[model samples]
Target: MSNELYHKCHEAISQGRAILEDLQQWDFETIIQYPQAEPQSTASHLSTTAMPSTEKTTLAEMESGLKGCSLCSLAKQRKNIVFGAGNPRARVVLVGEAPGREEDEQGIPFIGEAGKLLDKILLAMKLSREEVYICNVLKCHPPGNRDPQPDEISACEPFLKQQLALIKPELIITLGRFAAQELLKTTQPIGKLRGQWHEYEGIPLMPTFHPAYLLRNPSGKRPVWEDMKKVMQRLG
Candidate 1:
């Protein structure tokens, strides 16, 4: 082994010994060590070498991976993979439920009239779609715009988690009850979830009415505006 590899082995042993000492009640002798055999070429060894880095897979790579994914039944009926699009390094990420007719057709989230409303709302805050990331809980659209089944959400959750990990947003704004409930893992209604700051995997989450819902209930815009104010304050 190289000097670096020797040092790494020593550090690992020291850490293991510390853990064993701390957990005195447990048997540490049962620990297993699996060694990887060396490859033939220097290129192969370089490929296998581990590096300390935080960069994640690109959004395009993620979408490509999901293109053929059949993790849930939604894959069968989906006309397109609404894999989400926007700035990958966005500070804010807007999460919604599943796709609708336009979204399914275009393979993008938050399109059509609802999307238009979202655009206006963002403009009012002096932000544009290019400035933030947008995605849905389900990458594929549920037929007839129905609520995503629990199993479907579970199947597609890892993609969302990966997107979050890659974006590493300072704030996440969930639209509608389903988005809030699914991301926050709470059964609370939108009314209860809104107007207060919450945390999802350590990132600040703000739940508010969906743009489609806002189109239906224009009166509720007041509270949504309140929630938006909080988001802007934090982002500022």
Candidate 2:
């Protein structure tokens, strides 16, 4: 086979393997409780602090620690932790895949141009950042801001789960495909994931486009608006 065909075959095989792995772990009933297993160390430096105490550490302190975390390989390349910011006790939580260059520099989630668009969307819903919590599936920025690897998600998921447990939000808004897929544990495309309400550990989850994606594909905004309306209706 020619080199180009050989590369295509390799890509296909890799995708197949990923799908198989995703399917094997797609048990909706499995509730991942907190204070669970620790992640294996990566190239990034691990902190000396103990696992965040359920009660002792305030959300701010926990976030501070997370910002300094070096639990995964992304830490080595990241400029900042991109730990989520906003009202810790917010009723709605917005979860994305990971940080990008802008977010990494600011050490905040959803603050870039895409973040600005998100703000507009939230305002359209008559909501503000102070009213809701925003976070990413992975705390650190992935290289080139590419999609997060499965292992990276696995390593970072526990922290997000812990945050959810602590905040105990009424609803979760999964921004974009990665967040929806990881939280919902489905191989279905984002088109199917949207326009529906799913549950995660009893919290209502609404999937929508990532602001960054909407920046590229303006037409996607319509469905995302629909999803936001559902969130508003539920919250209202």
Candidate 3:
């Protein structure tokens, strides 16, 4: 067989293997809940004040306002703009970079394989999706799941800020490098950012590896669990 065909065959086999792996039920027992500790004070001057006022006071209003949004080219090909889901009045808000294939299809955040893993992680922390608000930095999916462009983020960030302003969550958890960097406005690697407590708009923010990363690197589960344990302890 030619080299090109050989590579294609290998790629197909790898994709099939990944599909099979995704289909198998993941073990949740490994996601044990570590004991929570008392929330500690941070010297970092980040405040707990609410975000600046916006026209949209309620999530409903925000969603309605975003209808037919065409601020960026992403809206042109997107099936739906993922407005987000979960408790509108949640104390904790989970933020991701952007929508993926399944998220774009369903117009929901974190509903794919990575989402399933996130559900398990939340369960391990004795939390449910209903207890937290989930959203993304960009409402629309980038073509081929590429990194969000600067213009796209600029167009979409205001809506996200408005969402946070309305929700006024006590704490925020950012998933993955892009989510963390974009919100924090820093270029620090996730390894350096994770396992540390940061602040965003006066709310305590924690950065951790995305569940999709955990799927690819099973060893990352331990550190992500450590991060969640810190979150639980902070909420206590």
Task: Please tell me which model should have the higher TM-score, number 1 or number 2.
Answer: 2
Better of 1 and 3 by lDDT: 3
Where does candidate 1 clash, by residue pair? none
Ranking by lDDT: 3, 1, 2
Q: Which stretches of candidate 2 lie over 4 Å from their true place?
A: 1-57
Q: Candidate 1: global Cα-lDDT?
A: 0.83
The lowest-lDDT stretch of 10 consecutive residues in candidate 2 is 47-56
TM-score of 1: 0.76
Ranking by TM-score: 3, 2, 1
Superposition-based RMSD of candidate 1 using all C-alpha atoms, in angstroms: 13.6
lDDT of each: 0.83, 0.81, 0.86
Q: Residue by residue across 1-236, what tens digits does model 2's lDDT show?
A: 99999999999999998876774454222333445456745442343323333232457756654544555567678888876878878999999989989888988898889999999999999989999999999988898888898667867888888888888999999998989999999988888998799999999999888999999999999989988888889988
Q: Tell me the lDDT of model 2 at 211.
A: 91
Task: Name model 1 segments beyond 4 Å from true.
Answer: 1-56
